[model samples]
Target: MTEETHLNPTQPVNQQIYRILRRDIVHCLIPPGTPLSEKEVSLRFDVSRQPVREAFIKLAENGLIQIRPQRGSYVNKISLNQVRSGGFVREAIERAVVRRAAILVTDAQLYQLEQNLNQQRTAIDRHQLNDFFQLDDDFHQILCDIAQCRLAWETIENIKAAMDRVRFMSLDHVTPHEMLLEQHWAIFRALEKHDEQLADETMHQHLAEISASVLLIRQENRDWFTEEQ
Candidate 1:
């Protein structure tokens, strides 16, 4: 694996390493089951073993790596169960969030949502996949913020790691940016009308799209998934 040389120097070395490694793992640049050595990583990043080890610990805590005392650390295979559980929690929480947002969203927030959608369109047209992904996240987060349930997004963040890995994997192939944009537009329209039921239903259908992609991804990348999948 190539070292990330552009990490912010002002941050703690461990945090910088952790973020780089986490991004690599989630994006499948560092494939599942690949061994990660503290010594090698330290050398690669021109950092010391201490920070590398600390980064490994954080990655393990996030379920992105498995650390075996004697065998060393390796990237964790994607857990289907974890993805399903996270999806369930996200769907439940986000459905409620959108329902509330539909009722409570202000004109200012609605304009912000429109701007986000416009940026999303630009990302799609330019084929900037990563930008699209970040904008997609921002779109949902705005809904949570408008709902006065910003903390609920923090909850989703914790459980959605596996789902995010799946999303990154699916981005280049299965899931089209336009499709996701359409779903977001649908949810926005429902919210525009302040129709809670329609917003709830739209959110449900939006999330279900991931479930469909998961099956295809699991089949194609069998080695990247745990046996439970």
Candidate 2:
């Protein structure tokens, strides 16, 4: 709602609603445990409740919300176990993906990646946290593209919801944007040299950063996380 004033009529209404709600949830703009209502959301988006209901189903599937019959729906608190588990899986998949990219990446692909890095730097300079967040994901996605593993990135997107919440928080509190940009550069350099091992290692280290920051972030914002695990 805060990010986009209006949903594009050209896109599927349900998809746009799902993405906007997901972005709001991940950014903690709506915060954890906040109640959600189909009627309210439909009113907010000025669309029919059917698309809002469809969007809620997708959010629940991603573990971003809980829908209770009669009880109503609410955003789910961040799960430490889910976040760590998701990170482990993502790191394994991405490590392999980056290694493969190093071997297969062409000069043109490297140039494209360089342009992405430049855009990342610009985002950082402009203090555009959201833009930088998207660009960071784009950099990793580009590597997956170079490796010819679109499925790998798709799988990551499905599993990374909890990880994404922490990632957004860490950008402000734990990991500095400059440090992240440097890590991106390191991974880019390894790909440029076709150093598969270095690429694998850098990707591992880069992804491992979130694991190190999650605890501190939880401490700073205790209510955002669940205590069960």
Candidate 3:
């Protein structure tokens, strides 16, 4: 594993604040149903209420948080319906992408994939969970690109914004990091051999893990979830 690194030189102050708060919400730092106030964020970040409001708007737009006017904002709660819907959509798109990648992946793309896998492996070995998580995202992006399915990936990204809350929770319980690594390797092997079935299966299995993880998170953190309301 490699040492953890951070994303710096990001967007301007408001966007950067939005990104930070959004991630914290998704990662459960804010927790579901916890009230968030414009005045609180403004005080904490030593900024005016306007940037905090802007950040809240971005989060609300992405379904990560809710702003109920005078009632203030809170982290968005989980919905089982959303998870099931996301799983179905994500699984179908990724299966097709993996199959296409098996046929159309170029040597250069394969090389890049190998590099990404190596980065992930290093992150895992070093126990750099944050870097590992980010690389996991990169690994999937590269596969989707190799398959010429950027549009599908863009769609997934929007769904994933909501799904990430459960994903981060499941990340806490998962001991199968090696299984994830192996799945990526399996996809690479299929691409090398131009084996469509194998590639499709590999991606299918890889993507399916998210569903299982979400269930585990909901079970383990039941308090964070409402009664499907």
Candidate 4:
């Protein structure tokens, strides 16, 4: 809830609003438990309340916010159960994705993965957390593409919101970027050699980091998480 930001005139207003708001939520820009006013968000984006309402509905569906009819809407606190469950599903899906990628990946696709790793390293060195986060996602997305299963990435995206918040927090606190980078390298090497088992195992270890780091993250940012665990 700050000054108005420009929006793409070509894109659907509601989707633009949703993506921006989603990114803000995931990055903790609008920290958990913060009240969200439809009018304020509309003013911030220089849009009508209808689109903002639509975005809010989508956010609610994603469990990033709670909209109470008689009361008001607020960003939902991270649910530990949701994060752990999401991580579990993500690991199961991505382990399979990496294994398939190992069998199907081409030299060109492997080079793309290598480039992403390079960008990740540069982002870390420059302390560009946002850039590194995007690179990290792109690395996984590329794997799904190589596996010829775009729907797999789509499925992960839907369930990964809560997990993403903790991931952002972990990156800022306990988790080291270098550690994640090494894991990516391990996965990439397995894919390069077409080793399905190694690819699956490395991907499991990589995705499991979120679960492993969540307890420490919740301890550090206690207010950001729900007590309902």
Winner on TM-score between 2 and 3 is 2
Report the Cα lDDT for residue 175, model 2: 96
Candidate 2: C-alpha lDDT? 0.92
- Cα lDDT of model 3 by residue, 42-151, tens digit: 77777788877888887776677778876878877886767777779888888888898889988999999999899989988888877877788888888789878788
Q: Candidate 2, residue 111: CA error in Å?
A: 1.0
Model 4 residue-pair collision total: 0
Please give the CA lDDT of all the candidate structures: 0.89, 0.92, 0.77, 0.90
Candidate 2 residues 30-147, lDDT tens each?
A: 8888999999898888999999999999999888999999999999999898899899999999999999999999999999999999999999999999999999999989999999
TM-score of each: 0.89, 0.96, 0.84, 0.96
The residue pairs that clash in candidate 4, if any, are none
| Clash count, one per candidate | 0, 0, 4, 0
lDDT of 3: 0.77
Report the candidate with higher lDDT, 2 versus 3. 2
When 2 and 4 are scored with lDDT, the better candidate is 2
- Candidate 3 ranges with C-alpha deviation above 4 Å: 1-14, 42-51, 227-229
lDDT of 4 at 223: 83
* Model 1 spans with C-alpha error above 4 angstroms: 1-3, 9-13, 43-51
Model 4: residue 227 alpha-carbon error in angstroms:
4.7
Clashes of 1: 0
Candidate 3, run of 10 with poorest lDDT: 1-10
